[model samples]
Target chain A: DAMVIQNPRYQVTQFGKPVTLSCSQTLNHNVMYWYQQKSSQAPKLLFHYYDKDFNNEADTPDNFQSRRPNTSFCFLDIRSPGLGDAAMYLCATSRDLGLETQYFGPGTRLLVL
Target chain B: GESVGLHLPTLSVQEGDNSIINCAYSNSASDYFIWYKQESGKGPQFIIDIRSNMDKRQGQRVTVLLNKTVKHLSLQIAATQPGDSAVYFCAENEDTGFQKLVFGTGTRLLVSP
Candidate 1:
């Protein structure tokens, strides 16, 4: 099945350290999204890439950044991880034209110490 | 600020019973809504969706109701099982703008045997 895939299903980082999470999709969807979800909380959209065009949320912190090198690959970067930054990083992909169902990866759980 | 929210944070249901989860959105322009289920160590899986033009839509064992007037949405799960125990989130997509789906805080459903 064509699906979204995330690297490092579990991530551990120290405070003030930089970390990167990667996502790649075989679906070839034009829109790729990165979301941060805490325990039992909603997955908050940090940003998304629409066919190489990046859109960041207004309230998304400066510490968080995303890059999509191509249609199939995207990366989320945390400049300086904090204890509070520990959460599950989810990667999703959807078609470009209209509202389409999003496909999600297994997610990367980041533990910042 | 545009946001999607849930009415309850948790719900308890017995096995083989039905489950209902409620959500509210502040964006009237949101035309598309979706329900997602997330397991403990996995990413969210799409359950069903409803458009603003329609009041309801249903899938296997799942139904979604949209009340555009009150900006409310609900998800109903029939014949719930222990495997149905997870966090449910309602998401909305703005019809006019970027069309990104905004997720609610989520409601945890506990299925007791």
Candidate 2:
């Protein structure tokens, strides 16, 4: 089945170290999104790519960045991991059709020591 | 501009019972709405959706109701099962430019057997 896939379902990184999470999709969607979800809170939008165009949320920290290398793969990078950055990272994709629904990958849970 | 939100933080229901989750949005311009279910250690999965033109839409065992006038949305689950226990969220999006979806703080649904 065509679906979204994430690598390294669980990630551990030392404080101030860099970590990268990857997402791949077989659905051939036009938009890919990255979200950070902490315990008991909403999944906050970090950034998204409309093809190669990147759109970052106003409140997203500079420590977080994303890249869509091509149509099927996207990567989320944390330049310097902090303890507060430990959370679930979600990746999603949707078609360009105006009313299309998004498909999400199993998230990568990051832990910063 | 869509400010999607949910009314409750948590809900408890018995297996085989019906469950209702409610949400409210601030943007009337949002033309598309979706409900998602997220299990522990997993990503949010699309459950159902309703358009602004329609008040209700049904899926296999889920239904979404949209009340544009009151800016309210609700999801109904029939014959709820243990596997249905998860955090549920509602998201809204506009039909025009920048198809960014705004999601609400989720409601944790506990289905007890």
Candidate 3:
């Protein structure tokens, strides 16, 4: 099954430490996205890569950064982890930038201590 | 700033009953809309989508209705089951250069046996 995959379903990091979350896809899609979802809230878009062109949300904090080295892999790096930043990180992929459907991974749950 | 929101924060329905979740968007320029279902501890799964040109779209057991006049979107699920219990969100895609989505607060659907 061609799907999105995320590493370390659960992550624990100390406050102020840096943490990296990874996402890879076998769907061979052209667009990849990263979203932060807190409890009982909607998934908020942090950044996305449309064929390696990074597009960050205007309100996204500078501590959150994303890199897509290639079509199949994308990483989310948090420069300084905070307790409030602990949430589920989701990775999604879509064929193009239009109204196409997006497929999402299981998500990486981050816990900041 | 424009936003998307849901009228109800939570709803409970009995098994085999039909469920309807409503959402309202402030962005009149949003051309695309989608409904997503997020299970506990997992990423959101795409349910259905409706475009501004169309008034409604249907999937296997789900249907999406779009009312451009009022900028309201709705998801109707037939034969609600326990498996359908989850958080449902409505997202609108802004008609910008990029495919950015603004999601609603979300409505929790609880299907009771």
Candidate 4:
């Protein structure tokens, strides 16, 4: 029943260390998304990948990068973690795009020390 | 810049009563509006959605109402139960080919028994 899965429910990293979060989907979705959500705030889109094409948000920092190795696997890499990067990292997937309902994973809580 | 926001940050309702969460959006060109329920320590789950051409849509015990004239959206939960307590968010699909989702500030729903 677990369609979308994110490994390491909680992750801890040093301020300047690089960290990567992994996501996998059993739904065979073509589009995957990454979002960062701080306490009591809205989830902001960091970037998304449609197949092999990656799309980054205008406000997304260069420190954040994403990779989709295949159809079911995607990774979010924070090159240099900062205090402000401590938040929930959510991974979502959609069948195609447009009006499709996006399925979300349980999320990974990242803590930057 | 398009933004989505909630009218209230928190809402408390009796278990047997109905709960209504409101959201406002600045983008009128959004193709689809979706409602998501997110519990603590979990990612968002899709509840219901309404397209720009539709005014209302229903799913199980949840109903999504979209008022394009006012650029407003609302989610109504019938016969609220304690399990329904969570944060509800309204997201607008920007339809920018990537189908970017602009999420609203979440409204915390507390169903008290």
Candidate 5:
């Protein structure tokens, strides 16, 4: 099935350490997104890429960064992991920017100690 | 864009019963609506969608209803089964130059057999 794929379903990182989460898609969608979701909360958009054009949410902290190295692959990088940053990181993709449904991957759960 | 309810509300039903999940969206200008199902520790799966122009849309076993007047969206599942148990979310497709899915506070559905 053509779907979004995330790696390392669970991740453990030390405080102040850097960690990266990866997402790849077989759907070949033009837009990729990164979101942070804590327990019982909605997924919050951190940033997204539109065919290489990176758009970060205004309130997204500078510690969070994303990179789409190619059409099928995107990565979310946390420069300094903190206890508050521990959550499920989700990656999603859509065919285009407008009114299209986004397909999400099984998120990567990050735990910071 | 407030935090989708910090506390998840749950609906419990017997297997084979019909299930209805409701959501109140924030933006009146949202042109499209979608419903997603997220299992434990997994990503959101697309269920059904309804456009602002249409009042209802149906999938295999699920239906989505959109009320632009009240900014409400709902998902109805027939013959709800135990497998249907999950956190259901409603998202509005909003465009502000950039496009994104604004998710409503999700509801957890529990189906007992």
Candidate 6:
């Protein structure tokens, strides 16, 4: 079954330490997205890649960054982890940049200690 | 700023009963809407979707209804079961230059057997 996959379901990082979360897809979709979701809140879009072209949300913090090395893999890097940054990080993919259905991977829960 | 929201934060229902989850959107330009089910410690799974041109669309045991005039959306589950307990979210897609989705603060559906 073609699906999105995220590595390290739970991660623990110290304050000011850098951490990276990975996402890979067997769907071979053209678009990949990163979203941050706090407890009991909606998933907030941080950024997304449409075939290597990065699009960042206006309110996304500068500490967050993403890289898509190939079609199937994308990585999210947090330069400095803060206590407030501890949340679930979700990765999703879609066939294109249209109104297509986006498939999501099991999210990575980040715990900033 | 435009956003999506849900009326109820949580709802409890019997296993054999039906469930209804409602959402409202302030974005008038949103033409696509989707319903997602997210279990604890997992990413959201797509349930159903409806376009602005249509008022309703049905899936295996789920149905999505869109009211463009009121900018409201709803998801109905028939014969709810314990396995249907999860956080339900509604998302709207904005076609502005970049295709992105705005998610609502989800509603927790607790199906009790």
Best by TM-score: 5
lDDT score, candidate 5: 0.91
Backbone clash pairs for candidate 5 read: none
Candidate rank order under TM-score: 5, 6, 4, 3, 2, 1
The recovered share of true contacts, given per candidate in order, is: 0.53, 0.53, 0.61, 0.63, 0.90, 0.63
Which lDDT tens digits does candidate 1 get at residues A26-86?
9989999999887766888889888978889988999999988888899999999999999
Candidates' interface RMSDs, in order?
3.7, 4.1, 3.7, 3.5, 1.4, 3.6
**Candidate 5: Cα lDDT at A46:** 93
Model 6: how far is B78 from its true place, Å? 0.2
Q: Please, what are the lDDT tens digits per residue for candidate 2 over residues B1-113?
A: 32234444789999999999999876789989999999988999988888899999989999889999899999999999999999998998864467568887788999999
- Model 5 spans with C-alpha error above 4 angstroms: none
> What residue runs in model 2 are displaced by over 4 Å at the alpha carbon?
B1-8, B94-96
Write the residue-wise lDDT of candidate 3 on B1-94 in tens digits: 3233435399999999999999988689998898999889989898988888999899999999999999899999999999999999889987
For the second chain, the TM-scores of the candidates in order are 0.90, 0.90, 0.91, 0.91, 0.94, 0.91
Q: 4 or 5: which has the higher TM-score?
A: 5
RMSD of each: 2.2, 2.4, 2.1, 2.0, 1.0, 1.9
What tens-digit string does per-residue lDDT give for candidate 6 at B72-104? 999999999999999998999988677688888
Model 5 per-residue lDDT tens digits across residues B16-91? 9999999999888888888889999999998888888899888898888888788888899999999999999888
Per-residue alpha-carbon lDDT of candidate 6 for residues A1-113, written as tens digits (9 for 90 to 100): 99999999999999999999999999989999999987777788899999989999999999999999999999999999999999999999999998888889999999999
Write the residue-wise lDDT of candidate 4 on A1-113 in tens digits.
65999999999999999999999999998999999987777788889999999999998999999999999999999999999999999999999977888889999999999
Candidates' C-alpha lDDT: 0.89, 0.89, 0.90, 0.90, 0.91, 0.91
lDDT tens string, model 5, A8-109? 999999999999999999999999999999999889999999999999899999999998989999999999988999999999999999989999999999
Q: Give model 1's docking category.
A: medium
Stretch of 10 with least lDDT, candidate 3 chain B = B1-10
Q: Evaluate residue A111 in candidate 5 and report its C-alpha lDDT on the 0 to 100 scale.
A: 96
